[model samples]
Target: MIRFENVGVRYADTAAPALAGIELTVPEGELCLLAGPSGVGKSTLLNAVSGLVPHFTGGRLTGRVTVAGRDTRTHRPRELADVVGTVGQDPAAHFVTDVVEDELAYGMESLGIAPDVMRRRVEETLDLLGLAELRERPIATLSGGQRQRVAIGSVLTAHPRVLVLDEPTSALDPGAAEEVLAVLQRLVHDLGTTVLLAEHRLERVVQYADLVVLLPAPGAAAVVGGPAEVMAVSPVRPPVVDLARLAGWSPPPLSVRDARRRAGPLRERLAGCSPAPPRQVADAEPVAVVRRLAVRRGRVEALRGVDLTVRPGEAIALMGRNGAGKSTLLGCLTGLHAPTGGSVQVGGAVPHRTAPRELVRRVGLVPQEPRDLLYADTVAGECAAADTDAGAAPGSCRALVGELLSGVPDATHPRDLSEGQRLTLALAVVLTARPPLLLLDEPTRGLDYAAKARLTAHLRSLADAGHAIVLATHDVELAAELADRVVILADGEVVADGPTAEVVVSSPAFAPQVAKVLQPQEWLTVGQVAAALDGGR
Candidate 1:
């Protein structure tokens, strides 16, 4: 059980408390979802539970916070290791070992558990998280989603009574995300583990939450209640909730199955009218061409004989399961990873042979780890450096940052910003040059709904302005809204590639929530259905 009474946290430089008067109680054996917008105190609250807020983060904490009746104020994270297992947003930062098996066992070794018990737990965790095949792989060689699972398994092996996860499924593909969520469900029901997690992808986890804790904004009072009660008034909502609202369904549905059961009449109403089709980008001039591309890392083949063509004014969504060569393909485009065979030409020049300085003006890449692109001490310094590197106007990068994510202080350290904020800053850095070709790997990993909408609009504008965009992502709803074409890859090869609606609507794994609910219909988003209804009326 976790309890917070009149809890408030304030950093040294900031005047307003990051969180204040957050009175809540999470019962034992229940999975409680901590929901809020970006820059909110969701992470701050989780830190308070694990005794990291005032201890590791160097912040002032007010009032009492207890976990399993143990006051976090008295016990440090190491002291509470057996009772609390905390997994932060960045998994690589938490890893101490190179191999998957060693990282999973490191936490238990630190706690001095019996070797037999540790081995048993390690095997169980590997099977539970679908990481049996990757147990021997190096940590650096694994994909982003694989790292996330390993980070969670390392904590789960400790068998802590309370588990605190920050964005546990953010990096996972649809299938892998379900597996992780299923593991959490089993822990809550069978093992009596208390789960307190914060996630931006509400569609994946909201249906499983036993209790919902809603933080409307920074420094505001927190709301706690049943899932439906909180979601009706919550600022952030999933596609299913939005669809219910558009269809005028009372007591908005919380899951796809629920929404589908109530969608018969609405489906009939829109039967004759088709949603407006996406703009045609395939006819535009080629911006990049790949002919039989292949990449080898060590012995593993990351990409295999991939033939593709990207054109100006096109928005391509590169999608597949974790470790499916999506990031590797993106790297091939930006010259980060040279193809072992075949040819890749961007703007009439080979990416691997192009000069680095000249490549900046021809192509840009926003990698999965946003921090990798940032090196400056402060936000303003990073913007200035981007301008200098890209040969852009003095204020161009800063202006893009302001437009994409507002209210961030220029003097704040890039390290101190939230995960979503860091990603936005890195995106601004890449966009400064206005490259003809843009590639982003998991661009909306930590963004909330509002932030995702802003990014979607900005990327759409770029595509319309004759920029070719290829983004590797697992966010299906975003693909439905922004991508003109969908390209699915599997095991280092393209499995399917076609127009967005044709590809996503036909596939079960990649279909958006609205598409699932209104099956036998071609609608892919709530906006599409809303437009159809208004036009019909």
Candidate 2:
């Protein structure tokens, strides 16, 4: 249905091609996945298919591109609207309506479809994407994942043959991501719609991908194949694949379940791979304490009277499904949102009562969205700004910023940098202040495996250095691997809090594959699982 012939694209103001000599095709109804590290032209390729590359983006395009038998250069976005629906990473950036139902109907209405057809399509989309219950909810009231689904529903209602999504599940929680993926699966199986999606979280979506297109890092080539062929041969792969490879398992497992089922002599190979248990440092003094804290957003009570405590050197993961008030609790902790009742004390000081500058020294918070913290002309400048404050020494700030950029890419614009890089930079800035407590919101949202490893290492280092770390995330793997304790919140109140292994690895809401396989064992990390398998052997 779509084909790229020797496609090479270069954005203006740069010498390198974003996409280089790409030759590929997608048959009708094929759920193709474009995978690679960031800035390797996954988005560029998707944009090419939707006529957004040379048309809206104003970039140089070479070679021929055709979608549904029409030349992409000749077919404008409006002309190809009926054939293709594209959803970018930031759903908020593309929102055209404030209500859920209205947003779903906007695209069909714009195409001049009849009212009956539009309404029918909208209802079907809402039902398929499981948005019928939220059809009348305000877009503002919906959770991040719900809004993302609404974004896809709006595009899907157009009844386009091809759906191209750029990191559609990046902002969604695990359960919500499953909902979106389930809808996509239905669309492919029931409606025969083609899907070409670009996403960084390969672990969640990799197994379902029928065709995988692996792009090389900038200035390299692209690789494409079916699931087993691509995953086995590609340079980039999920952790399970890496484990399978390292353990000498033939027909490598794509998921942990398959690995367990196929376990043989390979189990012995993984026996000695366990990481050291995360230390549980004792700090009698709690740095931050929340007691009966209540937070209200508009008419909704986002957080009820909630209590949480963080002691120096303790790492606690605050987890919940989307809209369960994890972010609201973080907001209250960081003073971004004032509590409606009760109190929140940070580093033994009341958050709302302390000055913002004083809060900076006592507590560091990396917000859910990294873009809010980045606005400098260069990556270095953003780092510099993050390191320095009103009273911090300029020399000290510059030195810290330089250290932060040690592994970051050269000449890369912070805005143009990948999600993981931006996240790393944000954390580096937060760490520059050397606060006693660090608050990280959805810290692993867009990170790939390597970046996630680095992040885990950094967090471990921070905890080892006696810093209190509070992370609000849906990443069960990170929580399992890094956190010493887990605190689960539901409807703004703490529902569970205990050892990370008990609260996260064993909890129904966030159990890792290893935990599921060895349910009674309570293994959370790959290392732990490896040790168990080895000990069994």
Candidate 3:
């Protein structure tokens, strides 16, 4: 059980409190979802629950916060380790050991648990999180999704009464995300654990939440209730809720199955209408070409005999399950990984052979961990450095940042910005070069709906201006909205590649929420159906 009464938090040098007037309660044995826009203090609230707000973060905390009847202000994170397990947004920052198995057991060892008991709990957690195969892998060698699961397992092994997770499923594929959520459901129902999680991919978790907490904006009080009650008025909503609204369904469906059951009439109405056509680009030369591309990392063949091409003004979505070679392929494009065999060319030059200064203008990458691309102490410094490195105008990078994500202070440290804000800054850095080819790995990982929409618009404009964009992502809705082509990879090879609608509509796992609800129809988004209805009327 977690309770907050008149809680307010404000960092030094900030005019307004990051969070204010927050009154919330999470009952025992319930999974409560903290929902809000980016930079809206969702993470701040989670830190408060784990006793890290004022204790470690050096922020001013007001009022009372208690977990399991113990005041958090009195108990530090280490003091509450027996009852509270917290996993932050960045998984790599949480690991203390190099090996997967060791990292999972480190938390328990710190708590001074018996060796035999710790071993048993670690094994149980490995099986629960599907990490058995990765027990011996080095932490640095694991993929983003693998690291995410390991970070969660590291905490889960402690068997804390309360679990706090931030963006738990953002890095996971749909199937893997379901597994994690299912495990949480079991913990709440069978083990009587209190689970509090904040996630932006609402379509994956909203249906499973026992309670939904909506923080409309920074410094605003939160609204807590059933999923449907909160979603009706919440600023951020999942795709299924958008569909229910578009179809004029009363009491909007919270899950795909519920929406599908009532979709008969809407399906009939959209039967004669087709999904929106992909955007057209003027005929131009190929920006990049891969011929029989192959990459081997250690003993694993990360990519195998892959052939692909990107033309000017085109958008491609690289999609697949975890460890399916998506990131490896991106690495080759950015010259981060040397191909074991085959050839890769960007703008008629090999990326691996290109110099760093020249490559910044030819190609750019926004990696999964946005912080890796940032090094300056403040936001303004990073922008200035990007301009110097890219040989761009003095204000170009800052302008891009303002356009993509507004209200970010120039003087704020890059580390202090929220995950989404960091991502936007990284993107601005890459865009400053005006590279002909752009690659993004999981760009929507921490972005809320509004921020994601802004990103989509920016990418569209870039494509129209003759830039090639390729993004490796697990966000199906983003693919549906932005990708002109969908390429699915498996086992280091391309399995399916075609136009967006043709590829995703046929695959149940990759289909968007609207596509699932409007099955037997090919609609992939609420915007498509809304357009059809308006045109028909």
Instruction: Return whichever of 1 and 2 wins on TM-score.
Output: 1
Candidate 2 lDDT, 47-102, residue by residue in tens: 99999989987789999999899999999888899999999876777789999999
Clashes by residue pair, model 3: none
Error of 2 at 533 (Å): 7.9
Q: Report residue 415 deviation for candidate 1 (angstroms).
A: 0.4
Q: Please report how far candidate 1 places residue 201 from its true position, in Å.
A: 0.4
Off by over 4 Å in 1: none
1-537: candidate 1 lDDT, tens digit per residue: 999999999988986788999999999999999998888889999999999988999789999999999999899988888999999999899899999999999999999999999999999999999999999999999999999999999999999999999999999999999999999999999999999999999999999999999999988999999988888888999999988878888788898999989999999999999989789765866999999999999878999989899999999999999999999998888888899999999998888888988787889999999999999999999999999998898999999999888878899999998898999999999999889999999999888998999999999999999999999999999999999999999999999999999999999999999999999898999899999999999
Model 3 ranges off by over 4 Å? 281-283
- Steric clash count of candidate 3: 0
Report clash pairs, candidate 1.
none
Q: By descending TM-score, how would the candidates be arranged? A: 1, 3, 2
Q: What's the lDDT of the predicted structure labeled candidate 3?
A: 0.93
Q: Candidate 2: where are CA atoms >4 Å away?
A: 264-276, 390-413, 529-537
The sequence of per-residue lDDT tens digits that candidate 3 reaches over residues 1-537 is 899999999999987788999999899999999999999899999999999999999899999999999999999988899999999999999999999999999999999999999999989999999999899999999899989999999999999999999999999988899999999999999999999999999999999999999998889889999999999998999999988888888788999999999999988888788866778866678999999999999978899989998999999999999999999999999888888999999988888889977787889999999999999999999999999988888998999999888889999999999999999999999989878999999999889998999999999889988999999999999999999999999989999999999999999889999999988788888888899899999
